[model samples]
Target: MHDLLFTVPGDEFPFTASVVVHVDGPRHVVRRTAGGDVHEVECTADDVDRVVDEALEALLAPIQVCRACGTPSASPDFTAVFERMHYICFHFEFEHGDADRDQACGLAGCPAG
Candidate 1:
Protein backbone atom coordinates (compact mmCIF):
# COMPACT_ATOMS: atom_id res chain seq x y z
CA MET A 1 0.00 0.00 0.00
CA HIS A 2 1.39 3.35 -1.09
CA ASP A 3 -0.04 6.78 -0.60
CA LEU A 4 0.26 9.10 -3.57
CA LEU A 5 -0.05 12.77 -2.78
CA PHE A 6 -0.25 15.44 -5.45
CA THR A 7 0.06 19.10 -4.62
CA VAL A 8 -2.98 20.83 -5.99
CA PRO A 9 -2.48 24.14 -7.76
CA GLY A 10 -3.80 26.38 -5.06
CA ASP A 11 -3.55 27.28 -1.39
CA GLU A 12 -6.21 24.71 -0.72
CA PHE A 13 -5.62 21.17 0.45
CA PRO A 14 -3.69 18.83 -1.80
CA PHE A 15 -4.96 15.64 -3.36
CA THR A 16 -4.04 12.66 -1.22
CA ALA A 17 -4.86 9.05 -1.77
CA SER A 18 -3.63 5.55 -1.04
CA VAL A 19 -3.32 2.85 -3.63
CA VAL A 20 -2.83 -0.84 -2.99
CA VAL A 21 -2.30 -3.14 -5.93
CA HIS A 22 -1.73 -6.86 -5.87
CA VAL A 23 -1.65 -9.56 -8.48
CA ASP A 24 -3.76 -12.68 -8.30
CA GLY A 25 -3.06 -14.76 -11.35
CA PRO A 26 -5.12 -13.09 -14.09
CA ARG A 27 -6.76 -10.65 -11.72
CA HIS A 28 -5.70 -7.60 -9.78
CA VAL A 29 -7.09 -6.29 -6.56
CA VAL A 30 -6.80 -2.52 -6.38
CA ARG A 31 -7.68 -0.51 -3.34
CA ARG A 32 -7.29 3.17 -4.04
CA THR A 33 -7.56 5.87 -1.40
CA ALA A 34 -8.92 5.29 2.07
CA GLY A 35 -12.43 6.31 1.09
CA GLY A 36 -13.48 2.77 0.22
CA ASP A 37 -12.82 2.84 -3.51
CA VAL A 38 -11.89 -0.75 -4.03
CA HIS A 39 -11.81 -2.41 -7.43
CA GLU A 40 -11.36 -5.97 -8.51
CA VAL A 41 -10.31 -6.13 -12.13
CA GLU A 42 -9.78 -9.11 -14.35
CA CYS A 43 -6.68 -8.90 -16.48
CA THR A 44 -3.76 -10.92 -17.62
CA ALA A 45 -0.54 -10.91 -15.62
CA ASP A 46 0.89 -9.06 -18.58
CA ASP A 47 -1.60 -6.28 -17.84
CA VAL A 48 0.34 -5.43 -14.71
CA ASP A 49 2.71 -3.44 -16.83
CA ARG A 50 -0.16 -1.49 -18.27
CA VAL A 51 -1.57 -0.89 -14.79
CA VAL A 52 1.80 0.39 -13.64
CA ASP A 53 1.92 2.67 -16.60
CA GLU A 54 -1.57 4.00 -15.92
CA ALA A 55 -0.97 4.34 -12.20
CA LEU A 56 2.25 6.22 -12.80
CA GLU A 57 0.42 8.62 -15.07
CA ALA A 58 -2.33 9.09 -12.49
CA LEU A 59 -0.23 9.46 -9.35
CA LEU A 60 2.34 11.82 -10.76
CA ALA A 61 2.19 15.61 -10.77
CA PRO A 62 0.70 17.55 -13.62
CA ILE A 63 2.73 19.25 -16.32
CA GLN A 64 1.76 21.91 -18.90
CA VAL A 65 1.02 20.97 -22.45
CA CYS A 66 -0.11 22.35 -25.83
CA ARG A 67 -2.63 20.10 -27.52
CA ALA A 68 -4.88 22.72 -29.08
CA CYS A 69 -3.45 23.86 -32.34
CA GLY A 70 0.00 23.68 -30.74
CA THR A 71 -0.70 26.46 -28.29
CA PRO A 72 0.52 26.58 -24.74
CA SER A 73 -2.19 25.51 -22.30
CA ALA A 74 -2.64 24.52 -18.69
CA SER A 75 -4.28 21.28 -17.75
CA PRO A 76 -5.74 19.92 -14.58
CA ASP A 77 -4.61 16.83 -12.70
CA PHE A 78 -3.56 14.20 -15.17
CA THR A 79 -4.55 10.67 -14.42
CA ALA A 80 -5.16 7.30 -16.01
CA VAL A 81 -7.56 4.65 -14.83
CA PHE A 82 -7.87 0.99 -15.61
CA GLU A 83 -11.49 -0.09 -15.14
CA ARG A 84 -13.67 -2.80 -16.62
CA MET A 85 -10.45 -4.27 -17.96
CA HIS A 86 -9.68 -1.16 -19.98
CA TYR A 87 -7.34 1.78 -19.76
CA ILE A 88 -8.73 5.32 -19.77
CA CYS A 89 -6.88 8.60 -19.61
CA PHE A 90 -8.38 11.57 -17.80
CA HIS A 91 -7.72 15.17 -16.75
CA PHE A 92 -9.44 17.60 -14.46
CA GLU A 93 -9.52 20.94 -16.20
CA PHE A 94 -11.18 23.56 -14.05
CA GLU A 95 -10.86 26.27 -16.64
CA HIS A 96 -10.88 26.58 -20.40
CA GLY A 97 -14.47 26.65 -21.49
CA ASP A 98 -15.18 24.13 -24.16
CA ALA A 99 -18.39 22.60 -25.37
CA ASP A 100 -16.61 19.79 -27.10
CA ARG A 101 -14.21 17.14 -25.94
CA ASP A 102 -10.71 17.19 -27.34
CA GLN A 103 -7.82 15.15 -26.17
CA ALA A 104 -4.88 17.13 -24.92
CA CYS A 105 -1.41 15.97 -25.73
CA GLY A 106 0.31 14.68 -22.62
CA LEU A 107 3.30 16.97 -22.99
CA ALA A 108 4.39 19.97 -20.98
CA GLY A 109 5.33 23.11 -22.89
CA CYS A 110 4.96 21.69 -26.33
CA PRO A 111 6.30 24.17 -28.84
CA ALA A 112 3.62 26.23 -30.59
CA GLY A 113 4.85 25.96 -34.15
Candidate 2:
Protein backbone atom coordinates (compact mmCIF):
# COMPACT_ATOMS: atom_id res chain seq x y z
CA MET A 1 0.00 0.00 0.00
CA HIS A 2 1.40 3.36 -1.05
CA ASP A 3 -0.08 6.28 0.83
CA LEU A 4 0.02 9.41 -1.33
CA LEU A 5 -0.81 12.55 0.54
CA PHE A 6 -1.79 15.79 -1.23
CA THR A 7 -4.15 18.75 -0.91
CA VAL A 8 -5.11 21.88 -2.74
CA PRO A 9 -4.33 24.25 0.04
CA GLY A 10 -5.02 24.82 3.72
CA ASP A 11 -8.11 26.76 2.72
CA GLU A 12 -9.81 24.17 0.52
CA PHE A 13 -9.73 20.76 2.21
CA PRO A 14 -7.55 17.92 3.28
CA PHE A 15 -7.40 14.50 1.66
CA THR A 16 -5.25 11.48 1.01
CA ALA A 17 -4.75 9.80 -2.34
CA SER A 18 -3.55 6.26 -2.12
CA VAL A 19 -2.58 3.63 -4.67
CA VAL A 20 -1.54 0.14 -3.83
CA VAL A 21 0.32 -2.04 -6.27
CA HIS A 22 1.05 -5.53 -5.17
CA VAL A 23 1.59 -8.83 -6.83
CA ASP A 24 -1.08 -11.40 -6.24
CA GLY A 25 0.23 -14.57 -7.84
CA PRO A 26 0.24 -13.88 -11.59
CA ARG A 27 -1.00 -10.31 -11.73
CA HIS A 28 -0.40 -6.90 -10.25
CA VAL A 29 -3.28 -5.29 -8.43
CA VAL A 30 -3.75 -1.53 -8.44
CA ARG A 31 -6.07 -0.20 -5.79
CA ARG A 32 -7.38 3.27 -4.96
CA THR A 33 -10.60 5.00 -4.18
CA ALA A 34 -12.59 7.88 -3.00
CA GLY A 35 -15.06 5.03 -2.76
CA GLY A 36 -14.24 4.26 -6.39
CA ASP A 37 -12.36 1.08 -7.50
CA VAL A 38 -9.46 -1.29 -7.88
CA HIS A 39 -7.78 -2.53 -11.04
CA GLU A 40 -5.63 -5.53 -11.83
CA VAL A 41 -3.19 -6.07 -14.69
CA GLU A 42 -1.60 -9.30 -15.76
CA CYS A 43 2.18 -9.57 -15.77
CA THR A 44 5.01 -11.88 -14.79
CA ALA A 45 6.04 -11.45 -11.18
CA ASP A 46 9.67 -10.70 -11.99
CA ASP A 47 9.29 -8.22 -14.86
CA VAL A 48 9.69 -4.80 -13.30
CA ASP A 49 9.03 -2.93 -16.53
CA ARG A 50 5.85 -4.86 -17.17
CA VAL A 51 4.70 -4.30 -13.63
CA VAL A 52 5.20 -0.52 -13.99
CA ASP A 53 3.52 -0.35 -17.34
CA GLU A 54 0.53 -2.30 -16.06
CA ALA A 55 0.27 -0.20 -12.98
CA LEU A 56 0.33 3.06 -14.94
CA GLU A 57 -2.28 1.74 -17.33
CA ALA A 58 -4.54 0.77 -14.48
CA LEU A 59 -4.13 4.18 -12.89
CA LEU A 60 -4.76 5.97 -16.15
CA ALA A 61 -7.86 4.08 -17.18
CA PRO A 62 -10.76 6.38 -18.03
CA ILE A 63 -13.42 6.61 -15.37
CA GLN A 64 -17.11 6.13 -15.97
CA VAL A 65 -17.66 7.90 -12.70
CA CYS A 66 -15.06 10.47 -12.00
CA ARG A 67 -13.80 10.56 -8.48
CA ALA A 68 -13.96 14.37 -8.62
CA CYS A 69 -17.49 14.28 -9.94
CA GLY A 70 -20.04 11.67 -10.88
CA THR A 71 -19.80 12.59 -14.56
CA PRO A 72 -16.88 11.81 -16.80
CA SER A 73 -14.08 14.33 -16.78
CA ALA A 74 -13.89 16.88 -19.58
CA SER A 75 -10.29 16.01 -20.33
CA PRO A 76 -8.76 13.25 -18.35
CA ASP A 77 -5.27 11.79 -18.74
CA PHE A 78 -3.82 15.16 -19.65
CA THR A 79 -1.60 15.02 -16.61
CA ALA A 80 0.53 12.54 -14.77
CA VAL A 81 -1.28 9.86 -12.83
CA PHE A 82 -0.25 11.20 -9.47
CA GLU A 83 -1.21 14.78 -10.42
CA ARG A 84 -4.58 13.66 -11.68
CA MET A 85 -5.26 11.38 -8.74
CA HIS A 86 -4.18 14.05 -6.32
CA TYR A 87 -6.75 16.43 -7.77
CA ILE A 88 -9.44 13.75 -7.71
CA CYS A 89 -8.80 12.84 -4.10
CA PHE A 90 -8.66 16.49 -3.12
CA HIS A 91 -11.82 17.42 -4.97
CA PHE A 92 -13.75 14.45 -3.63
CA GLU A 93 -12.75 15.28 -0.12
CA PHE A 94 -14.36 18.71 -0.31
CA GLU A 95 -17.16 18.23 -2.82
CA HIS A 96 -18.58 14.97 -1.48
CA GLY A 97 -19.94 13.88 1.88
CA ASP A 98 -20.30 16.21 4.85
CA ALA A 99 -17.85 18.74 3.59
CA ASP A 100 -17.25 22.36 4.47
CA ARG A 101 -18.17 24.17 1.31
CA ASP A 102 -17.16 27.71 2.23
CA GLN A 103 -13.67 27.37 0.81
CA ALA A 104 -12.78 27.09 -2.84
CA CYS A 105 -12.65 23.52 -4.20
CA GLY A 106 -9.07 24.21 -5.29
CA LEU A 107 -9.32 21.80 -8.17
CA ALA A 108 -9.27 25.01 -10.16
CA GLY A 109 -9.70 28.75 -9.82
CA CYS A 110 -8.20 29.15 -6.41
CA PRO A 111 -5.00 30.53 -5.02
CA ALA A 112 -2.58 27.73 -4.16
CA GLY A 113 -3.67 27.78 -0.52
Candidate 3:
Protein backbone atom coordinates (compact mmCIF):
# COMPACT_ATOMS: atom_id res chain seq x y z
CA MET A 1 0.00 0.00 0.00
CA HIS A 2 1.14 3.50 -0.79
CA ASP A 3 0.20 6.78 0.92
CA LEU A 4 0.45 10.34 -0.30
CA LEU A 5 -0.20 13.77 1.19
CA PHE A 6 -0.68 17.24 -0.27
CA THR A 7 -1.35 20.83 0.77
CA VAL A 8 -3.73 23.13 -1.07
CA PRO A 9 -3.95 26.79 -0.20
CA GLY A 10 -5.73 29.71 -1.81
CA ASP A 11 -7.57 32.97 -1.26
CA GLU A 12 -11.01 31.43 -0.89
CA PHE A 13 -10.14 29.09 1.93
CA PRO A 14 -7.56 31.32 3.60
CA PHE A 15 -6.19 28.21 5.29
CA THR A 16 -3.75 25.41 4.60
CA ALA A 17 -5.63 22.43 3.12
CA SER A 18 -4.43 18.89 3.67
CA VAL A 19 -5.10 15.79 1.55
CA VAL A 20 -4.02 12.18 1.78
CA VAL A 21 -4.27 9.41 -0.82
CA HIS A 22 -3.97 5.73 -0.02
CA VAL A 23 -3.57 2.91 -2.52
CA ASP A 24 -4.06 -0.65 -1.40
CA GLY A 25 -4.39 -3.30 -4.09
CA PRO A 26 -7.83 -2.81 -5.61
CA ARG A 27 -9.03 -0.45 -2.92
CA HIS A 28 -8.23 3.22 -2.93
CA VAL A 29 -9.07 5.70 -0.19
CA VAL A 30 -8.77 9.47 0.10
CA ARG A 31 -9.12 11.90 3.00
CA ARG A 32 -9.00 15.68 2.99
CA THR A 33 -9.32 18.55 5.46
CA ALA A 34 -9.93 22.29 5.39
CA GLY A 35 -11.11 24.88 7.87
CA GLY A 36 -11.04 22.24 10.59
CA ASP A 37 -13.49 19.92 8.75
CA VAL A 38 -12.65 16.46 7.40
CA HIS A 39 -14.13 14.15 4.75
CA GLU A 40 -13.16 10.87 3.11
CA VAL A 41 -14.11 8.56 0.23
CA GLU A 42 -13.21 5.10 -1.14
CA CYS A 43 -13.13 3.51 -4.59
CA THR A 44 -11.67 0.72 -6.66
CA ALA A 45 -8.01 1.21 -7.47
CA ASP A 46 -8.15 0.87 -11.22
CA ASP A 47 -5.35 3.43 -11.43
CA VAL A 48 -3.90 5.98 -9.04
CA ASP A 49 -4.36 8.92 -11.35
CA ARG A 50 -7.84 7.84 -12.36
CA VAL A 51 -8.90 7.36 -8.76
CA VAL A 52 -7.65 10.81 -7.77
CA ASP A 53 -9.31 12.42 -10.75
CA GLU A 54 -12.63 10.75 -10.13
CA ALA A 55 -12.51 11.53 -6.43
CA LEU A 56 -11.77 15.21 -7.04
CA GLU A 57 -14.52 15.43 -9.66
CA ALA A 58 -17.00 13.87 -7.26
CA LEU A 59 -16.08 16.42 -4.61
CA LEU A 60 -16.23 19.50 -6.83
CA ALA A 61 -19.16 18.38 -8.99
CA PRO A 62 -21.83 19.21 -6.42
CA ILE A 63 -21.31 22.97 -6.30
CA GLN A 64 -23.13 23.71 -9.54
CA VAL A 65 -25.85 25.62 -7.70
CA CYS A 66 -25.42 28.72 -5.65
CA ARG A 67 -26.47 27.83 -2.17
CA ALA A 68 -27.11 31.45 -1.24
CA CYS A 69 -29.29 32.60 -4.18
CA GLY A 70 -29.90 29.27 -5.90
CA THR A 71 -28.65 30.87 -9.13
CA PRO A 72 -25.56 28.75 -9.77
CA SER A 73 -22.16 30.31 -9.14
CA ALA A 74 -20.15 31.40 -12.15
CA SER A 75 -16.94 30.58 -10.32
CA PRO A 76 -16.60 28.37 -7.29
CA ASP A 77 -13.63 27.79 -5.00
CA PHE A 78 -12.87 24.13 -4.23
CA THR A 79 -10.96 22.31 -1.47
CA ALA A 80 -10.56 18.96 0.29
CA VAL A 81 -11.07 17.17 3.66
CA PHE A 82 -9.22 14.65 5.84
CA GLU A 83 -9.94 11.59 8.00
CA ARG A 84 -7.57 10.07 10.59
CA MET A 85 -4.69 9.41 8.16
CA HIS A 86 -6.36 9.74 4.73
CA TYR A 87 -8.05 12.48 2.69
CA ILE A 88 -10.23 13.43 -0.32
CA CYS A 89 -11.80 16.44 -2.03
CA PHE A 90 -14.98 17.13 -0.07
CA HIS A 91 -14.92 20.66 1.30
CA PHE A 92 -15.77 23.84 -0.59
CA GLU A 93 -17.26 27.32 -0.18
CA PHE A 94 -18.80 29.52 -2.85
CA GLU A 95 -17.19 32.74 -4.03
CA HIS A 96 -18.11 35.67 -6.34
CA GLY A 97 -21.37 36.56 -4.64
CA ASP A 98 -22.66 38.37 -1.62
CA ALA A 99 -19.59 38.33 0.58
CA ASP A 100 -21.85 38.45 3.61
CA ARG A 101 -23.73 35.35 2.55
CA ASP A 102 -21.06 33.47 0.59
CA GLN A 103 -19.50 32.10 3.73
CA ALA A 104 -22.72 30.24 4.40
CA CYS A 105 -22.72 28.44 1.06
CA GLY A 106 -20.37 25.64 1.83
CA LEU A 107 -20.68 22.42 -0.19
CA ALA A 108 -21.26 20.30 2.89
CA GLY A 109 -24.13 22.47 4.13
CA CYS A 110 -25.75 24.54 1.41
CA PRO A 111 -29.43 25.26 2.01
CA ALA A 112 -29.74 25.91 -1.75
CA GLY A 113 -33.01 27.67 -1.10
Highest-scoring model, TM-score: 3
Error of 2 at 48 (Å): 4.6
Q: Candidate order by TM-score, highest to lowest?
A: 3, 1, 2
Which of 1 and 3 is the better model by lDDT?
3
TM-score of each: 0.33, 0.26, 0.38
Please list all clashing residue pairs in model 3, or write none if there are none.
30-87, 31-86, 31-87, 31-88, 32-81, 32-82, 32-87, 32-88, 33-81, 33-82
lDDT of 2: 0.44
Q: Comparing candidate 1 with candidate 2, which one achieves the higher lDDT?
A: 2
Query: Candidate 2, which ten residues in sequence have the lowest lDDT sum?
Result: 2-11
**Deviation (Å) of 38 in candidate 1:** 4.4
What is the per-residue lDDT of model 2 for residues 1-113, given as tens digits with 9 covering 90 to 100? 33322222222333332345566556655444333544444445577466564454444354423445434444555345423444545445644445445554444543233
Q: After superposition, how far is residue 85 of candidate 2 from its true place, in Å?
A: 19
Worst 10 residues of 1 by lDDT: 82-91
Count clashes in each candidate, considering only residues at least 3 apart in sequence or on different chains. 1, 0, 10
